[model samples]
Target: MPITSYPFDGQDTTETQYSLLFRELQDTGIADTYGGPSFQVSATGAGMTLSVQPGFAILRGHAVSSTAVETVTLPDAGTSSRQDRVVLRLDPAANSIGLAVLQGPDIGQTQTDTGIYEMSLAIITVDANVTAIDAGKVFDERRYAGSHVGIWTTNLRPVHPRRGRLGCNTTTGRWEYWTGTAWTDLIPGTADNTTRWNGYTLTVSTSTPSGTPSPDRIWIQPTS
Candidate 1:
């Protein structure tokens, strides 16, 4: 077994050592703020050019960042609509970081392969014979660390929340968790079986209420 340690006085550090350090600190993905978009990609509003805003990302444990806007010129579209992915790629063999495109089919979803340590930033759909790209043609696909406990509004939440994943629901202003079946409230008292509008006092009971509905009261029964 080979054991490695570093950072002593007058120590000589190499690229391998730095990569190991980065991999340990963060997972491979675009760095994101809680519930916020990361490494935004947008069309320059003309031509086939796109602009990737400055952002930090990790690929295969190697950290890469763009301090200024990076531009990419896409190839002309084919006869049919084509989906092209913009990726931040790290080629460990060449010790290089390249902004590249992965061409996709007109009918199927684009495949993102991690074997090459690439983090996809966006997907652009080019119509046949289209000369200009617009904001509507681009879709942002940047992903953050799965273990990250990010806060998100209902509309901005991840498309699929996995089991035991924790997130803050800005819409309800409550913490929620995925329980392998549904998103249940993390806080005690109110739960997944319950719903209320505008934080109105919701009275939960084992049986239905007998009296007429009160304008100020909301009643809900927990599922059997």
Candidate 2:
């Protein structure tokens, strides 16, 4: 007669008592095989969401939330500015995640030189085991100078005069004669300091010249 097979119910079936053992052995005839720990979740689903955490670390990296996208503002400094929004992604071949500025409103449109320019979310990689790395902290805008200006002068002598020379008053629009290297407030009307003969003509020189000197004459010119 053929053997009868019993149906499997919720009751314990150990009473039937037929032991079965299946083992996978290596070519060296070893019973134990080498294998890594099993994971319940796949590598693609391993990434976790993170928010604005202080200080960068292997576990807690900066990530962009759906509600809040990282933004950088640059004021007009008479040039174009730029802002990069880098995204971190897994690289299986490299065994480490990498950072790339993925999507944004025209990275090239950001001003290159401007007031209060910002570069937000530059990326940094951590390790292979980690799935994703977060964005870097926002760096404030730094001013770069394109041009500058400074005071310049052509006069080599001091503003104050000595001997019979007249001193220049930077405050008032008048030149006063120096009384022994010191400025005299008085304005001499007709005072002769020296006399000379020019082409058999008597020419008197005063502490202050009356009119513009000849082109070859040595005299200090007023400056702006």
Q: Show model 2 residue runs off by greater than 4 Å.
A: 1-78, 101-224
Q: What are the Cα lDDT values of the candidates?
A: 0.76, 0.29
Using Cα atoms with residue i matched to residue i, what is each candidate's TM-score against the true structure?
Answer: 0.62, 0.15
What is the Å distance of residue 140 in model 1 from its true position?
Answer: 0.7
Which tens-of-lDDT digit does each residue in 50-148 have in candidate 2?
232122111011111222322222222222223334333323334343233433235431322211122233322323334333233222211111111
- Global CA lDDT of candidate 2, please? 0.29
Distance (Å) between predicted and true CA of 113, model 2? 38
C-alpha positional error of residue 14 in candidate 2 after TM-score superposition, expressed in Å:
36
At residue 147, what lDDT does model 1 achieve? 59
Candidate 2 deviation (Cα RMSD): 34.7
Top candidate, metric TM-score: 1
